[model samples]
Target: MKIKIIKIVLFTLIFIIMLSCITKILQPKDDGAIYGVRTFFAQNNNHNSDILFIGSSHIHCSINPAILYKEYGISSFNLSSGSASFWSIYFYIKESMKYIKPRLIVVDMYTINQGAPYPPDFIFKRFAISMPLSLNKINAIRMEASKNVFHYYINPLVFYHERYSELNFIDFLLYKGRKNRYKYYKHYIPSVKVHLQNEPNIKSIYDVSKLYYKVEEYYLRIIKISKINDIPILFIVAPYVLSNEEQRRFNEAERIANEYNVPFINFNLNYGDYNLDFSKDFRDAGHLNDEGAAKFTRYLGKYLKENYDLPDRRGDPKYYSWEMNAKYHDKDIYNIELKQYTNLNEYMEKVKNADDYVIGITMLGNYQKNDRVLQSIATNFNIDNIYLKNASYVVDNNKLIYSSDGSNQYLFHKEIGSYTDLVIQNGQRLSINRRNYIKTKNGINIVIYDKFTEEIVDNIYLQKY
Candidate 1:
């Protein structure tokens, strides 16, 4: 009987080890805002912070903590993920307090409008995968997860077992517990996408008639907790394309804030205050892209420094992580700016008035389509296929005219073109690189100009293959 017991124990231990190995080798990739929150908890250590911001994906990209630290000396952390609901946030704040002591809590009041039991399946999955196991999570399951509480808590693999087939290097990374640095806007996601024009103007369709009972319940708990701890809590609605119906719901949020005496700032109504251009600022209708985030952070940092008593942790060796994170964060911003040169018109606009950048107006592609010479490059050279087509270019007040197949003969889909007569207007005077062309000939012209001297610093012509 003792021998049989030992065999059973040995099999149990083997099964547990196999389970851990399998789970590690076959997990899905993480994305969206949950990736940031997961990294913070798994690898980062933030025992003390001057401010803590929490909320949905909107806050994840809207508020940048690195900028706050760089400009205002604010020491902060973001404990949020995409689609974080009221009860979940309440629990998150509670869990975070175990390690961090923050002076203020900033909650973005966007998801509060959804109010209720279980959210949509996708958003719920964000919580299921990102949230760690604890009593608060169990309570979260009980209150919101309802019947699937056991499956969510005790047996996550039961739902995700099929992931075994989709294993890859990312799965290994997941097993190794790799994480991203906080250089990414603290918890705020930077935006690289720019939606300039042609966006539809959407108005609100529904008014939030009443708050979800659970939402009100959890929101009240937040207020009560803040009061007990004597910690200042601020509720804010980040800037987005808000509709009138949505405005009404947030108005309801404001009413509740007033009832609790918590300050609520709706940034959507204060776009001009932040000088945020909706077309250029938003990554999507819901989130601020990188450029907008920097602007908002600069504004918010200055405002916080002036209005709040948050300490500046810059130059303090104890907060060296913040300084290091700031460097990486700016590096990401520089990378984002690099993407703007992809479109030809955007590239020109960026260097339109600038002088320090290197502008290369060269023929891109095989030069099959007769196209105009590139106008200018600011920071780096922009080689776009769009500019390497049957197009005409007139630069330096017609000092140089690059015509492909001639304007009188317009080919519908002709794909043969070249860069001819590259007129480079650097600082002053048009330096035209006139290429010797035979009939149906193609080559590239380059003009390097100094902006300050207004002089043709250098020029060249080349063959495009």
Candidate 2:
């Protein structure tokens, strides 16, 4: 009887271990926003931020921590889950406090109208998968997940087991551990697409309906936690293409904020102060693109610096990681800006405006020296003439680094970072690490490199019809 009991226990342990391994392999990777940001915050000592930005996608799309640190020397993080309701935000705030002690908490009020007792299943899945086994998470599962779906959130394998058939090598790799993808952006993702739409003329309606009971309850709970922790909380409404109904809801939120004596700012009504151009700033009706995010972040950074007692850790050795992350952010912004232009003329014009680009312009075969576009580039670069023969020009920033019109004698080589080299031959052939990038040799070949990242951004071949 004793031997049989021991055999049963050993077999059970082996089965449990195998099951754990299978469950991990089938689990999805944590996107930097939902679970990854919280993991990053807990792991990195430098991520003990001065301010915490929390809410829905609006906060993630608008509030950029790198920009805040770069422009104002203020350390911050965006701990936003996409489409998270107030209940989720409350739990997120609870989870975040275990990692970092923040001075101020900025809450986005965009999700105030979400009246559901629980978030959508997809969003709930993200929350459950991201949270570890804790009393807080258990309570969240209990209250937020219904009895029918509770098992699914707790043991995700119940639902995700089918994913095993769809798994690739990435799934096996992630089963071990995942890296912090949002390290550079600090949990911010920038959208580059430009969306042009007329702003809705939403008149303030003071007599709008009251806030949802659950929303108000969770919101107050957040405020209570902030007060208990001695952290100041600021409420904000991020600017978006608003509707009359949304504006009315925001009006109701403002009244609540006033009652709580919390500072509230609705950016939709004060777009003029931020110099927001609706045509170029928005990626969609609801979110700001990179350009718009820059403007909004700059304004907020200045406001925080002036109003709050935040430290400026710009040149300090302790916060050197922030400086490096800022450079990475700048590189991403430059890359996005370069990718937006397809026309050679417009692309050259943008490069001319930015001072941190290494530009290579080559003309191959027979080309018109008097071409208007060539003349415009020559005028901007202050060149005396445009070459009619095969010619190559390398401009570092706005300064002429190297220029050669010879077809055979022109050979330029520069090591990029550690592994790659920028090589040019005879004004026509352009290669990075001997990999051909020029689309055509018959016309003009141009390559642009970002000075901050030391990486090639774009290669363009333009021909006149």
Give the CA lDDT, 0 to 100, for residue 10 in model 2.
100
On residues 1-465, what C-alpha lDDT tens digit does candidate 1 reach at each position? 999999999999999998766654654555455566665566445764788888888777887888888888888877787878888888878777766767888998888887557777666666666666687767776766658445754476775776767765446654223232422225556678877643323333334457788888899998888888778898988777766666777888888899878899877666778788867887778778888888887887787678677888899887776776686566555444644565645544543434332333433234433423333321223323234332333333212223232233421211111211233221122233332221222454444333222223334444445
Q: Per-residue alpha-carbon lDDT of model 2 for 1-465, expressed as tens digits?
A: 999999999999998898777866776765544544454444465345788898888988898888898779998777787777788888878878887778899999999988778777887777776666677888888878899987877775686866878886556753122232234336677889898979777654456667889898888898889889988999998888877887887888888788888888888887889999998999999899988999999998888899999999889877766776686777678777777776767777777877667777787767576687678668766566567767777777787766785556778887643344677777656776577667766777878776555567788777755
Name the runs in model 2 displaced over 4 angstroms: 1-25, 29-39, 172-185, 343-465
Which one wins on TM-score?
2
Prediction 1 global C-alpha lDDT: 0.62
In model 1, the Cα lDDT at residue 350 comes to 41
lDDT of each: 0.62, 0.76
lDDT of 1 at 45: 53
lDDT of 1 at 190: 68
Best by lDDT: 2
TM-score of 1: 0.68
